[model samples]
Target: MNSPELQNVPLFAFATAMEFSKVFPEDSSKAESQNQLIPLSGPFQGCFACILGVGILDFSAGLASLLFNCKQTNFKISAVISLGICGAYPDRGLSLLDVVNVSSDRVGDLGCEEQDGSHTLWDKSILGGNCCQAPAVIQKMLVALPQVVGATVNCCTGTATTAVERVKNMGCDVESMEGAACFAICQKFNIPAFQIRAVSNIASTRDKSQWKIEEALEKLHKCICG
Candidate 1:
């Protein structure tokens, strides 16, 4: 909940209440130390948290509303932290539960498809850039974590073909549902955006048995909320 610098308060944004849906003791240290799943607690001291719903539309609306509220209330947000679990691309040297800081994010599925079945991005003259860069200032604060490129997709990659296509299209190491939208919206608001995600599964397959949802959620909680 604390800003990357711990000097200012940030609005921690999430796509959903995935792991933080349960209420529990405010003191999660005891449970966390015992290697248990820590339940939802209060916002970390001196910060705010917002649920941005799921997908880009909900995320954009929630973030815009929050920004508008801040403007009306004269609340200054130091930055925006997009926190969640992500899937790692194959052969990316990434592992499950590895919390990584997204250095940049790009759109995963928006492009112009040609007759040859290839896709191309829009012309760059009219707000056509699909990639959003995370400010270096915020990234410096998270130097301890591995910094990887990310892609924000409306549909999560559930098959090897989809995964390969996404990586080929986006050149991303990890993929999330709301990362680029968070970054782009924050850009419009002149707020630095930071995305941190814990790897949950290989972005290649939809095999539930191979995914580590609960474990990844626990690691995600520890990474950002610990």
Candidate 2:
């Protein structure tokens, strides 16, 4: 019996380089070989539809390639979802292990500054504006998740000063590296896409001593499994 949820959509799951390695550790014997995509079997497999893991820089390109190749390879992919960790803004009152659902994403560092202090980027050139909105289903999922928050960023936002500046500008609940890029790709493909992030640290100052990466990852796994 075909499940309606798995009928056509392929769930694309993305994580940063470090995060990916942590979740999917490499086999020493296969170190030199390309990592192959295997069918993820579990509750998520049935509910997710299709799954693709992507890196930060290659997320958009990878999804496009996956969609194009999957057609030839006899896989039908419909939706994309990313799960990972991010920095939390102090003002949002989010703590370590809290999850965030992105409502939109923006390339915080892409725009060029003008003499008048105005900034602009590709969306401004092509669409006469700059805005990216996530799909409604994703938003609904975010609301359903336990202890979920909203996220945004200006630049990569790893450092204290940078994170503070971004929080002041965007007032987002969290910050991450690849959310905006993933949002851009999903928007282009007209795919229902969403982002889920676990807070590993406060967006204020970059303190390696205070990071709860392992704990956050554990919580994220629980969220996904639940």
| Worst-scoring 10-residue span by lDDT in model 2 | 123-132
Q: After superposition, how far is residue 18 of candidate 1 from its true place, in Å?
A: 2.2
lDDT tens string, model 1, 1-226? 2224433456667776654331112542333221111223354555555666778788888888777666555666777777778899998899988888887887777777889877785412112112243333334446678878887778888899888877777677998878888878887877877877888888987877888877887777665545
Best by lDDT: 1
Candidate 2: segments with Cα more than 4 A from true spot = 1-7, 16-36, 46-56, 72-74, 113-141, 146-155
RMSD of 2: 6.1
Return the clash pairs for model 1, or none.
Answer: none
Model 1 Cα RMSD, 1 decimal: 7.1
**Angstrom error at residue 140, model 1:** 8.0
Cα miss at 72, model 2 (Å)? 4.1
Where model 1 places Cα greater than 4 Å from the true spot, the runs are: 1-8, 22-43, 123-141
